[model samples]
Target: MQRYFIAPEQFGQHTVTITGEDAHHLLKVMRMKAGDEIMVCDGLGRSVLARLTSLEAKSAEADIIAEMETNGEPMWKVTVAQSLPKGDKLETVIQKCTEIGAAAFVPFQSERSIVQYDGKKEEKRQQRWAKIAKEAAEQAHRSIIPEVSQVMSWKQLLLRMAEFDLVLFCYEKEGAAEGSGIADVLAAFRNTHDSSREAAILLVVGPEGGFTVHEADEALAGGARLAGLGPRILRTETAAMVGLTCLMYESKEMGGA
Candidate 1:
């Protein structure tokens, strides 16, 4: 069944109003008519099986059939703090990482970042990124949409390190002796923290040219643990997804019983 995310206010005790692009997609794109069954999510980790009650030119209504049980989300809330990469690579990262169960994304300008932040177009760019996340979430059958934050500076990102329980800094220059492998670091974190509680984790990936030695030093000083993905050096766009996949696997959200 096709899924559509609806705002909380639009969802009532036993009915949901679908408007905007979602309404258009259902009415025209999908050619869905009244009485058709579909899935509706509140984007707050609640979903329902709903049957269309009314269809209009610009809006649609559905009667809630039953609450759904969705387990697509990861137990840990992993946010990707990615340094802005050149071109549309950030978009690729947002789309793929969201599918891989990223809770949120924070794009920051690193010292080696080639793409300069454009304040004039920031809102437009954020909207685009958010749309990508929403679509990916719906496709992946996620209960909640991942958040895409406004671009931040390296200093600002470092300051926000205190917000998470663990910050995994993906540094290419980090030697095997200097940094713990992702699995080891995650194991340590899991052992220390309460497994039943949802932990906030930040996975930081640098830009194409990677982070400068000084920047890495500052992050380490700010309590971020240096973590290596593996022996191979991944591209900036690949690092976040790889790191997140490793996290999910280690956390038993992927392959474990």
Candidate 2:
């Protein structure tokens, strides 16, 4: 079924009003008419079946049928804090990571990061990232859209890190070090999590040049686990996705019984 994301206000008691470009797509492009059935979601887990009842020049109204939670979301939130990479690497990161079920993203600038964020560029980039995330979520049939946060400074990144129950950093050096692999740390973290309470995981990945010694040390000091990906080094864009995949797998959120 084709799915459309509707705003909160558009989702009234038992109706959905899809407006603007979306309405145009349905009416003109898709040639949908009254009595056409479609799936609609608020991107907050409220997914429902709706039957189109009216089509206008700028909007389409539908009657809500059934509402249910989408199973595509992870059991817990997983936010990736990625150091800015050069070119359109960040866009690719947002796009793929969202498809893989990342709950949110934070693009930060570290000492060795190749990309610098100016105010104007940052605003435009955030919007672009947000759009990418939304499209990826819709394509993946995800009920919730991942948020792409503002470009953060080192201190700002740490402040957000404080909110997560556990944080993991993709540390290449740690791969060769004894007992510091991602699986090891994640296993321990899962064992210790309070089942009575909720938890969030923050996965951090360095840029193309990787995190400098001081930066890595700061993260370690801030209670972020420096878990190694593997023996081979991963690119800046690949590390976070790999880390997230490992984490979700270990946590039994990725198809484990």
How many clashing pairs does model 1 include?
A: 0
Candidates' lDDT values, in order? 0.92, 0.86
Give the Cα-based TM-score of candidate 1 against the true structure. Answer: 0.96
Say which candidate scores most in lDDT. 1
- Clashing residue pairs in candidate 1 are none
RMSD of each: 1.3, 1.5
Tell me each candidate's TM-score.
0.96, 0.94
The deviation in Å at residue 77 for candidate 2 is 0.8
- Predicted candidate 2 versus true structure: per-residue lDDT over 1-257, tens digit per residue: 88888777789998999998789889998899999999898877789999999998799999998886678887668999999999988888899999888999988989988778789777777788988997798888989889888889988997777889999978899987878999899889878997455569899999998888898898988989898998898998899789888877877776655
Kindly provide the TM-score of model 2 when superposed on the true structure, using C-alpha atoms.
Answer: 0.94
Residue 69 lDDT, candidate 1, scale 0-100: 96
After superposing all C-alphas onto the true structure, candidate 1 shows an RMSD in angstroms of: 1.3
Score candidate 1 by lDDT: 0.92
Clash counts for all predictions? 0, 0
Model 2, runs deviating above 4 Å: 195-197
